[model samples]
Target: MSIQDQEHTAEPSSSPADSAGTRRALRADLLRVGKIGGARSATSSAAVIEGHALIDRRTGVWVPLAERRRQAAAGSPADQARWDRLIEAVTRPTQPTEVSYEKLVVRVGSARDLLRTLADTLPPFVPVAEVAQRIEQRVESGTYPPGAVLAPGRIAADLGLPLQSVHLALSDLAGKGVIEQQANCRARVPGANPFNDRPRQLAQLLRALAAGGAFPPGTALPGRRELCRILVTGDKPFAAALRLLFQEGLLERDVRQRLTVRRGSVKRTDPPKLPAPAGHVKSLRDDEIPEAARRTRAWWNARLSPAPAALDQVIDQLGATAHQLVDRAQPGSVPPSTAQQQLSALVARTAITAAAVHHPHFELRLWHAACLATAVCDLLALLDDLDASRPSRRTAMPPLL
Candidate 1:
């Protein structure tokens, strides 16, 4: 056949339709393979979960709607609150997969949990001054009233402070006279609130009484406890006031335990009545000891250098000392000339020792020499007694040749 006739007679092969069908079949096969690969991967490796709850809520047996309705109908406020908590615990969302790895794997992420982990590494800060201030305020407020027992350990626990800090605070309070230590060593708030200026008040009153001739020389004063009651204060302030009187030669407790007024301690000034709110004035008196200064002026005054002795008396003391040294008056009764020579040697050694005190050498060579010299002097004196105790090795005295 001619070529044209063969081409025309050849049936159309339908290549377009065949190609379209093959392409569709290839796409469907690829999709099925991708699904199978995903399934295999999911089974082989586990996904990291960052949720607070490890077990899934849905894993539990499901409750029926009818039973839920019944529980709701029967629920009280407590039951309802409990149910709410359970619901919250179950429904609260957590970051299980906050980040992805190349769109295939997910990495679990932390939220507040990471911050909590770092909390342990941080240093703790304690508010020391604030705690002390709070405790002091409590004292002022009568939360710990006068004479009330205090437990340092219990207070430390309550205030979140170290036990040592609480102990130090107690000591500070005791030193301030805000508290007193008991026989048991436990601290108690003093019955006397000297912060109220009870000592100064008592001083003023006693001064007025002295001026009025109530306390003459050799007069017996009232008992301390009675004064404590009359003054509406405690023993601490009364004791302080009484002590000031004692120091000023205003009062003395005799061997009979009776308080005696000294001849002339009180100033004998005009007696003024105590102020209306009791002992304190609206404006504190200028003469009164300040509250901030816990100690009395007398307390400070007692610590002073004594008066120096007269020049003649000092010279007499030195001369007497010289004679005692020259005498060698002890168990050792050596001859006068021998003792004098030893003393002169000792004086020379001492002079050398004193001169070398600031020497560059760390060791004290000269001081050691002085010690040896002293030992020799003592040995020489001791030999005299030994010689007297024993029979002499000298030839028997030829009868008064």
Candidate 2:
């Protein structure tokens, strides 16, 4: 193709006034991938209206209406076939492939198969039903509502579960968007939806706030200890429960230390970042399949380029997430300096140091996490460097000797 032919084409502006025009153009092109609902803030009211106008009809499976329209206009068989495969690869599962060379052979599998295999490979997952039930009871009673802080230790002590298990449950709930966690280990329920029990907790808090006018909307609701007393539980369950509400976007903390509720019926916009499963890697395909497949591969390789992050950095980011989580479990507390010191001491030991230095995966996960932490440390250092900023902002209090 000539350079001119390959030049980029700009998408029509998704502006409010132009909705009718675009709807008329792209209406017949709708393709569904996932559940999409009524008008959202992210998509202006007009765009939502136009979107529904194009492909509002319900179907068992989703097809992107706009992309299909573009494919119909590809003007050539090769172009059309390419777009078709691209759409399929994204929407449907590709068949497994076998590779052979001399005595070596391997089979590449689908994401579904891999997840299933991993599930089977894992040791039986212990159920947390009892703990979940206990938390449910507290929520039903007047003890804990939305916007309560959690203390992992206290909860662990009360529930008779290891502190680590309680922490794990909280992590799982947070990932599920069943709660909202703040920096200082505080939590609140936004009650944006009733489906996941998040809405109930949130509704309870909203009703209380409405009646009591306690700490005006947008105020940091309360410290974890204070919330724990009201909720009649430790922090973990409270934080986990509040996470769901926060995900729904009913309540938000403002810059000036206020907790504000979105007065309107706005749906949540935050995307959840589910942790990638261990040993999961994007699949690479072999040369085969139909004509559509070849073109599909070429186009996807160009556009959906894979740029893997360094392994070391990923571990550090994971560590940072862990540290933040731990801090929340024990509010107004810091990780023991001696713990980190002991970890360093272990690294210095000859046997451990040698094993870590030699093991590639181990080294990758460790160093990657360290590299990320270093970047964070660098930013903190810069904050310290800024002389004009307020002393409070410029420096954290010095550690006690």
Candidate 3:
């Protein structure tokens, strides 16, 4: 039925209170009808309602369409003409516009320009010597102990310096014998007396003796010279071994500074089982990518306007790249060199994308990408270690005769 016919339908006469109730019911019906149509139709219906409805100046309530039409009919010619025009406008069909797609051309020079601008905005480059000095201080202070893997990536992150700078500093330290570095492996602090396994061996022997009840709790054991002779070790190694025992709370010094087995120290408990190894690359990528994306979304929402379509595209692309990297990182699937190359490419692309979009949080995004790349690289290194050990393990196996 036409809207005019629906409006003209007669209602039963009621009290003044009923008039307000009737108006609310009519408004609800109009809204329900609008919702029954789809979004565009609903929008058009809402526009028609807004165009027809008039506010009561005194009552501050919306005048119903029927009442407005009645007033227009009784009023001058201009009011009738205005109402007629509104009805015609509401009934008119909307036209579809021609869809034109434009190609987004990103010039290489423009990206370079953006990079230059970003570089200008960044903090001054930290000196390689300064980075090396900081790491040296950390090493001397025992923050990085012997046998600890000194990952360049981790050091770079901690120092907030470039990875290359950290690498150079590590190389210098390694050259000077401050740390040890080998090809395709992270740098490591040199252990005290690398040639001597005597201290560790003596430590194990003493621990076994204590566990076997040779030295019971609260009993004063041998002197330093006696231990050296009995254990067939020198004074230096015996002292070091005793130090290890002291650290383990198995041995303590008495009033005369004699070595005694500490009371309540002997507990013959089974060693805890180690957990099975997992795919580090897959686990790290899974954990970090989504977290980075969430942080990016929150950061953008809090500080900037809603993200544009291009930002979403960049995020999707990053996710796809991460997935691809995880797949390639499977055991013996892709070599470390290839994985490293791909990761480097991903980092560069992420930086370029951030620059292209003029993202204020570009540094944050780049850091996350670099961190993921570093984790993947570390995983590759671990895989390399496992592979290297396999042949040695095979050779060491007793021949089945």
Best first by TM-score, ranked: 3, 1, 2
State each model's CA lDDT, in order. 0.39, 0.34, 0.45
Q: Residues 215-304, candidate 1: write the lDDT tens digits.
A: 445567668775553333458877888877777777877789898777666554322221123222132222221221112111112211
Residue-level lDDT of model 3, residues 1-401, one tens digit each, is: 43333334523222133545544444443332332222332345443333232111111222234235426343223334433443332221233221101000111122222222223212364545666777888777555556556778667665567776577678667867888997766788888533235577567656655554445467688677755544444588778888888998989989988888888888643212112223332233445644545554443323222233434444444444444543343334223454434333333322232222332343233333333333333334444454554433332222111
TM-score result, candidate 2: 0.18
Q: Candidate 3 versus the native: TM-score?
A: 0.23
Off by over 4 Å in 2: 1-126, 184-188, 191-401
Q: Indicate whether candidate 1 or candidate 2 has the larger lDDT.
A: 1
Pairs with steric clashes in candidate 1: none
Q: RMSD for each model, in Å, please?
A: 32.8, 26.0, 29.3
Ranking by lDDT: 3, 1, 2
* Cα RMSD, model 3: 29.3
- State the lDDT at 7 in candidate 3: 34
